[model samples]
Target: MIATLVIGLREGLEATLIVGIIAAFLRRNRAPLTPMWTGVGVAVALSIAVGFGLQLVEQALPQAEQEGMETVIGAVAVAFVTGMVVWMRTHARTLSRDLQASASAALGRGTAWALAGMAFLAVLKEGFETAVFLLATFQASTDTGTAALGAVIGIAVAVLIGYGIYTGGVRLDLGRFFTVTGVFLVFVAGGLVLTALRHAHEAGWLVIGQQRTVDLGWLAPNGSVRGALVTGVLGIPADPRVVEVLGWVLYVVPVLAVALWPRAWRPSPERVPRVRAVLAAALAATAVVLAVAVPSGGGADLPRTVAVTGDARSVTASVDGDAAVLRVSGRGREDQITLPASVHRRVARAGTGADQWQVTEDVPATDRPTSLTLDQLVGLFGRVPVGVSPSTNPGPFAADWTVRDTVTLTTVRSGVLEATRSERNVLTLRGGGLPAARTTTLDRDVWTVPPADADRAATDLAAAQTRAAELRLWNAWLPLALLVAAAAQAALAARDRRRVRTPTTTTPGTDPSRGPPADVPARSLDHAVR
Candidate 1:
């Protein structure tokens, strides 16, 4: 909730400031505010719809797909927040000035809608980023309801603050406020990095460095207040894998350092090449590490085939992409049936063939019947082949025999199709010398792949995994790359500060005691409200 509240407060106030500026400009020009408000209302509604729609789509996906979607959303949220933070740090001082300049141009166009559209776009951009970031944070939170309420309250508070600033009823160091919030957001984004890395593994996007190296259970006991703050708010898991810690450290340390780095008043020409060289070297090292470190997994073993054979019949099946093809053989002929592949969460893709297919689903009655039935062949003075059939009733003898057939068709995680067929029969023997009933059963399972197509699919999947691993590795190393740049900035700041303290000769037209120029525009708040 605290994380979300800060996110909401910072984002909401930014939007509020924009709207306030636009409203004040219109009021000064004696232009009505209806069109601008209309645009803002539409943008807000669209942003809300986008957020809800994304959540709904995520919920409707399969487990693996859901994890994949979550990884994407979390990563995107982190990127948006990071970019916003960096951009705001540089632009906050000039924001009011820039908005006024744009507003003036819009009014000169002789249409209030132009300004309205500007307002709409400004709010919409912020709204979209807010929605995505909040969704990611909410998913990380243990109590989503509380998080959401906090966001609402934060936005409410931001509105009051924005109104106060506009009305000259509040006085604040806007520069200081943004700086503090910017630092806080950096930590939040760092946590999101950890969260995204964890999701990437669950989604099967990254496979290397999965060993659990840290145990934070003592620090974050479940259901404890500390746990809620540490795990939920901070986005740290009780037990994190090696990659997770690597990602968190690589992101947090360098990003925080850069965020807190002292600003330099002037650029140092001699140091530029040195800074570039350090960054280039870091990137090159990261590339070399990735090339050698990321593993190219050997192809996984194909699932073993299982078949049940009787005196005159047998059953087996193979995987064909998203579908399953079952083959049943009898006497001198073989028949095939195609069905959709069923996926079970508990089943292991690369396991002993014997242990596979522990759970099987019965073929539904809706399946189309085959041309020939085993019971018909049995009735022709042939040995009774009491084995599994695709259909419950497959021949005339089925009327005299009670047949129960259960079949399972599925595609395993390792890109293999597995099918199991089980059947039981009880036929009434009405002959003078025969017993009252005859009972027989057959069970079979098959795990196979077409030599060409299935192999290609597996290769493609492996290639995708490799690429994703490389991308994730590079992503984790990006912070170290940023550290190079930060180091240069710190060095420059130290040099400049030391020189200033040495009381060097002052330039003719410059005033050293004036310090840095103020960031806020004088007319920003004063002209925004009545």
Candidate 2:
């Protein structure tokens, strides 16, 4: 609810401001308001339709595709909002003048369609942004109806504020309003970045740096109120992966620094264009480097063999890209099976000919081989022969066997585990070599074969590589494009500022028919609305 409300208020107010400026300009010019209002109505309806249509389409997609779509939409929303924030920050002071100038040009054309187009385009810009933003918000939220209600309320409040301004009953400091909202929106955009990264990961497009950085699930488990608030409004998960944390930090730090930086510390108008051009070029270059440098697959290679040794027996597994093989051997008996990592289990004969028997088990998928330790493998498949005295009939005997083993296995990454297993095994011996009336010791050993650990590192790496490729386009390059665009806008704004500051030469007896001199400062259209 809070998430949707914030989005509603931020986007709704922007739209309201645009409408107020257009309406005030039309009224001041004595132009008919009907066409402009009609245009606004049509744009609003279209924006709503687009928003709902997107929602319906998302609902119809498979879970993986839905996650991918959500990621794309969230990323686009963040970019849009970031652009809007920066553009508004730089141009809010002159917004009224710009709107009035556009209005004058439209009115000069002497066509209602011109006025309508101006209003339509202005309102449509804000409306479309609102729709996309709301869509992203809804996807993040658990309750769509509540999110929609919050948005409706926000729009209502904005409309009331707009009406009050138009009636001269309210005065809002546009600069301060935008600055404050811009700061808030920066955080919101940061959340969108985190959200997009998560969705991309879920969609199997991103795979690197997946280790959990922190686990706060004990405090705010998923589906809990606390979790919802944190995840929905802030996009911080209870358990966040390394990439999510890194992405959030990278996005929020620089964005907030730029958005909240003091105007006094900003570059002088004379230096603005130079600075903007330099920044733009640097960003473009960096973008190119990133595009070229990021690898196409998981940065690590899969190991050829993963082996685990026990007290008397050992198991070794190998994967050759597509197929997997597991070999278990002990007590002069060797078992080999051709296993595909895709399946959960495989059954094969462990011994040759008369000594052969069917063994059924599988290797569990793991990030590294060490997770399948030698002790675990020994506990699962180790067998040793024991010679007993003649008095000890070996038809069926149950004995407790304790085995201690140290296991070290390394794959693309490394992990280690040491374990001891104590178990009671029932054994049936068909024949035994023992001496009668001779002092002989009884030997006991247990034999069993359990599932081997499947090396899923390759599969996971492949998935990660695919995700990284996708992110290079959506997350990395898209943001760079937006930065370049913002830089260009800043450069143009600086040029405009320089032009405005230049003094215009005027003769003492200028013709009155020419109206006010071009040097005359335009009255604030917002003030006219109030």
Candidate 3:
């Protein structure tokens, strides 16, 4: 939502400024307003149509193609915003003058259509920029309604501010305003650059640098509010990729430095200093050293296992780490428990009586079960053995069971059962036409660790192999270079600010009728359009 709001505010203000300048120019020249307004309307309609067309294209594409499209769109938005920020910073002080000059030229042509075309082109540029930015932000957001609402509010506020300025209700330092906003927009554009790189990776255009730089999953789960704000507004995911962080740093640092640097700091060919040259070389060396020292880490590929127990009435369990599977079968009834390694207690009961068939004692035990009493054995084997109640006739006693543990270990057993241990294991019961019975002795064994899954093991190998191949020196050094440039710019700005300047003085008795003189200020025309 905040992302969209910034987009609307920035773009809307640009459009409003253009319209205000054009309107003011036309009213001063006694030209018709209808044509300019019509052009603005048409440009607005075209921008909306283009936005919808992009959305349609995205929706119609396959997943891979959709990712590719998002990458392209994100790239375009970053470029547009970067260009806008730079252009505004360079031209803001003279913006009103330039717009008025252009308006005069268009009106002097004596063609209403020319004025309309000029307004159309001017507004279309800003409108289309807004459209693309909003589209990119919407793609990144989880709540479209909130994003849209924020954008609307931003635009409305921009309009109000523009009106206030035009009507003399408000005053602004346009140069400072553009400078500060340009700095902010540069960061926003950097976020878009990172977003684009991520999309490109998803589309498989780029295969290197898959390692995560940081994992914030524990602190901000994917769908949490804090996660959404970070990812959607700031473009930083909980788990960020190495390339994503590099891209952000590389793009933002230099761009922000350039935007924020004072104009007086700009180097003149005649004034290049030896100290500045030395600083540049030092910064480059530092970046090179840092780049060479940084190491790339490998990706993670953990193994998982699935365990199944029993037949007919079965229990299936899936676990990642250390675990055990316990199955109890007797009569026609069966029960299973997929216990974690931490579990150390067991409870059960027996009998045809409803109250008799209940869990009796459940006490914590430090060791795995190796022996059981008659009552405990009855509960472990199952409550209703042979599926017979006290009211029903009994069947001949018979029971068959098997417990197998596989993956990281393999273990198998048959007939009378006892306690067993394994990382991933399962127990099954067959032929359960039995009467209630108690066992006194049972056998148990520990499982041996087995080899990891072949596929996952292969993936881990590949990830290791790619570690060095994925290392890009530029990714590590670019931010350092930008930081150095920012420092240099700051030093230059400081020097320029401290230098004294002589003010030019007009000769006392110069002719007052010399066409108002070159230094005379132009009459303020802003009020005409307001």
Candidate 4:
């Protein structure tokens, strides 16, 4: 919720600021703001369309492909956002002036409508950016509602900022604002970079066989402060692939190089001392290095099986870590606590005893450091309901799942609970029967009722559900940040045009007004884009 709100609020404000600036500009110039509204509408509609399109793409994708898409978006977002941040910083004054001038020239078209159009288009540009950002984020966040709410708040704040700007009450040191936000963005981008890599790994796009990154579950989000921080920052899965780690490093390296290069450049005594440069570099290095130092193999989207005990005919128990789990609840008479297939057979086809009985206990083995498909992972809660498989919706259950150690229950006179233990088993439900045998790894929903502590099973399941919710929640909000960024870009552009057309005291191509900016010659905005 917080992530959604933050991204939404920030991005929303940006859009509102753009709208306000153009509206104010038109009002001052005695022009209709209709074109501005049209432009805004178009931009917003386009952004929405983009978001929906991306969502469709995400939904249509298989588990691995969905992950691959996520990875690509994160990488793209990091690149675009980081580049824009650096650009804004270097060209703040020049860009501002350019924006002012463009507004003036556009207004001169004598068509208040024309100037409004320019304003609208400017806002639209930002809108598209937001669209891309939101599309990426929507796929990553665990909740969309929170993200939507946050965006609304962001827009509201932006409106106020725009109003202040018009009334000459807003005096933001934009450079500083960008700097602080940029820093925050760096972490966010890093998270995305890490996340995308995880997706790519799942998709089989890149492979680094048999090496764990580092299991920092102690500090990792395996349920810790740092873990949450990392997750919130960029959908960063605690267990990352080599390629993912490499991607993160590559992306962040460039950002740091760009953001801190100037600060760290040793300057003469006459120049201002570079405290910020030193501090930024240290922070950047520390954050990355520490992340690297943390141990790998912390958490996985799927549960890591700890142990299981069952034989060919009937399997009785399972142990998830320290928790002792009971797999079969309907154990006939006698509390031997034994799952005897032979005895179950006695019950099976016996006179008037409901239906035949057959039991199988199949416990899966753990495989690591490899890419997994939807077939491999479950949303926690162990597997499906006892007897149910993951492939089918509420996949069929072999027998009554909730029975205690010994509870009387009816069975299908036909089927058998055939259990098989293997390192990687792929299960299939062929033609009719109970569970048509197929092969695969992983298990159906986990057996939640532990013979010892049923509550533990419930807790573990609940935690799994929570994690699933969180992953989706973060994904939903991630997009808002990008969208908000887009809006911010529009506002900055508008502001820049205003300054640009503001009739500077100097001539074109020559800065007599600011004394030619010392040794730097004035460059056109068009040139800057390249």
Candidate 5:
């Protein structure tokens, strides 16, 4: 919820500022509002198309491939966001004028296509950025409702702000606004960078060498809200590594230096308000350092866990090093679990996002352990909680008590509390200071699975597969679409070039070359226009 709001506010502000600047220019120049509104419509349409296209393509991706797509897109987003931040910092003073000129030029061209192209590019930039943010959030959260709500609120706010600025209802200090927001943007961009790296790491584009810098869950559990807030925003690892630490530094230091270090904006010393604006901007400039400079992630908090079980009827079970469970029942095809993945095994994401055993020996179909190490046992110290029960609302399935040790897991399902020593055993085990909580459900932050009796889980699995297939199909189709779009763009560029060159048969002494080069290369445009 908090993340959605932050994204809404940040992206909303960017689009709002763009529309406001263009509208203000139009209203001042006495241009008919029709073209401007048409441009707005075009922008909106393009943004929607991009958004739907992304959703469509994403829907077809398999889980791991989806992850890969997100990682690559996120990395691209980070680069774009960072570049924009740096560019804005250097060119903020001239932004308003450039926007006005661009708007005016687009209008003078009087081609709806050109106008649409201009607006589409502007809004598409915002849309792509927003998409990246939303996708990153989606990977971390399971709440579609919250994300939808945030996007709606962001668009609504942008509309209001954009309209108000154009209609002259608000007098904003454009220069100061960019300066302050630009600094805040550094943090926002930094978050994007971190998020991108995380996705990339998961997708195998980056690697964290085998190392656990610290494990402090016993000292201070990291699942708390405060811990969550810090981790989500700052990219702090509960267990750090040498590479991740250095990677963060390599990204943030240069950006911080550029943001800070005093620079004069309005050299008009006579303008006191500009100085005040600078001071207001100073606050953000100074604070941006905290985005990356604060180093506090080196702490031991990666969950250390253990697994335990009690005696059961109709079944025999063994425990490994005070953690993990394995059970074998007569003729029942061995059922056992040495340790529950979490104190509560959450039902979402197919038990991912936490309910994971650091299975060292790789549990196979066989019931025998291959090898075990003391290090593995110590790691298991924080792997399980000492309790088990059917989550009151197990949905469709009856409560399953799975006994799994180093090798096999036999899970039993039951509906009600009819237990003699004969019913599937209610195994309870405890270690450490945690209260003896019951059940195999993992954290609530994860997506919930359907009850045991509920067929929804199967349906969800089917749906995920369907989406994965669709993503595969889209992957096959995207190259074709890009080809078409590229062809269109090239054709349009050529047409534009033709229209700009040689206004056809200039009279003697009236050199068409007298015109200033509209497409002048940035470095040179020596002589003045006629």
Candidate 6:
């Protein structure tokens, strides 16, 4: 709620400021305000409609697709907020002057309608950004009701403030106000960076750096007020991944520095060296820590056996480090299929839950034609099993399922099978009975398999981890670089302030050694200086 409120107040004030400036300018010229008001009204309606449309579109998508859409929205929101923050930081002081100038130009040209257009465009820009940002915040928040109420209150306050200022009933320090709010917005935007990356991973667009960086459960426990503030308002997940934390830091450090740095300050020669040294040292230290922390990755436990049972038969898959065995049994019949070491490694790399492999076999004439189709695989269970029947013609089957601790059938086709463990899984069948998709049970059971090569599996997993770590490590360099730059900027500002405070010994004369000219009296010289 606080996040949305700040967003609303800041954005609403900016819009109101613009509209008020234009309205006052028109009134001074004795022009009618009807066109300007009409434009503002239309823009407001469009913004509201756009927000609702985006929400509807999100609701219409499948879970994974919805995640993808959310990733896009979050990304766009981050961009919008960043741009708004930066632009406002630099432009807030000059906004009224610039708008008045433009309004005057329109009036001089007798194009009063251009003023209306300007009002429309300015309000629309702010409105569009507000809609997107609030949407992202609402999605991230645990309590939408409070978030909405806060936003409404914020906008109302902004409107009142804008009106008060326009009517000459209120005075404000616009520059100071914007500077304070700009810093807060930077924090909000940094949180958005984390949100976007999380959505990307869930959308399956990003898979690297999946390692847990730290356990933050204690910091953000479920169903607690502190948790809501930390996770919901601050946008930190209970357990953040390497990439998400990296993203947050990378965005926050430099952007916050920019927000806090004074606009008029310039770099001082004396401060640059110290700032550079600090920055360089930080970068080197970060590199050393990352190098030493690269995971060795050989100590993973054996993956749990996934036993999937349908109406007619039950299939159990046990995967050791290097090999996988699938056991199928029902109706007094048993069959076993073992994946080769290479196939097993590939499947393991795909992800946990073995849901994404398509295996094809080239059978010799004598080999039982191991190329099993969907129908043949189903036959391994039983005849005319309950809820499952052979279909003469199979239509395209594409559905997504979400269940806890449940085995999901991902795909079925000729000579190919793919399945995976995930919160959201897709099912695509070419020939299986529709009813067979009704119910499936996933049980955790132990199955003994032949001893396999542990070293090879460990090596594979380690290499993958190392690669992901390398990517994250490189990505981290950018933030460190920006941090150094911000530090230097800050050091320069401090130096300037100290210079201002330190008394100057030099006189106003170009030559401090030369007193007032011989012909000039001391009293006259002092008055001239003053």
Task: Give the clash count for each candidate.
Answer: 0, 6, 4, 68, 50, 3
Worst window of 10 by summed lDDT in candidate 6? 407-416
The sequence of per-residue lDDT tens digits that candidate 2 reaches over residues 328-446 is 56668876656444542222211101111122332232321322222332343353333543245332222222223212222232211111112222223332332331121222222
Q: For candidate 3, lDDT tens digit of each residue in 200-297?
A: 98998876666788887776668787777667777766777877887788689867876887778876633444445565666666666667676644
Per-model lDDT: 0.67, 0.63, 0.61, 0.49, 0.47, 0.65
Between prediction 1 and prediction 6, the one with superior TM-score is 1
Tell me each candidate's TM-score.
0.60, 0.60, 0.57, 0.49, 0.46, 0.59
Q: Can you tell me which runs of candidate 2 are displaced by over 4 Å? A: 217-229, 273-530
- Per-residue lDDT of candidate 6, residues 1-530 (tens digit): 88898888889988988888788778767898988998899899899998999999999999999999989999999989888878877666456556666777878878778878888889999999999999998888878999999889889988997777776666666666777877887778777888888889899988766679998899989999888878878898878888788788878887888678864583564665566566556755665565456543332333333233343244555555545555556568876666545643233431332333223432222322323354543453334333444464232333332323222222111111333222222222333336434433222222212113333444554565567444554545444554565566557557755775677687565664333232112222122212
In candidate 2 the C-alpha lDDT for residue 265 amounts to: 95
Specify the poorest-scoring 10-residue window by lDDT in model 5.
521-530
Candidate 4 has its poorest 10 consecutive residues by lDDT at 517-526
Off by over 4 Å in 4: 1-6, 13-21, 223-225, 260-530
Give the residue spans of candidate 3 off by over 4 A. 217-228, 269-464, 472-530
Instruction: Give a tens-digit lDDT track for model 1, residues 1-530.
Output: 89999999999998888898788778877888998998899888988888899999999999988888888999999888878877776667667767777888998999999999999999999999999999899877878999999899888988899888876687767777777887888888878888888888899886765668879999999999998888878898988977788778877776676566656742364555556456556655665665557554443443424333342254455654545566666679877665553432344332212112333344433332222245554543265544433254344333244456655544444333434455544344332222233345333323233335444544665555555554554544444455565566556656655665666677788874332221233274523321
Error of 4 at 189 (Å): 1.4
> What C-alpha lDDT, on a 0 to 100 scale, does residue 25 get in candidate 4?
51
- Report lDDT (Cα) of residue 469, candidate 1: 51
Better of 4 and 6 by TM-score: 6
Model 4 residue 155 lDDT? 56
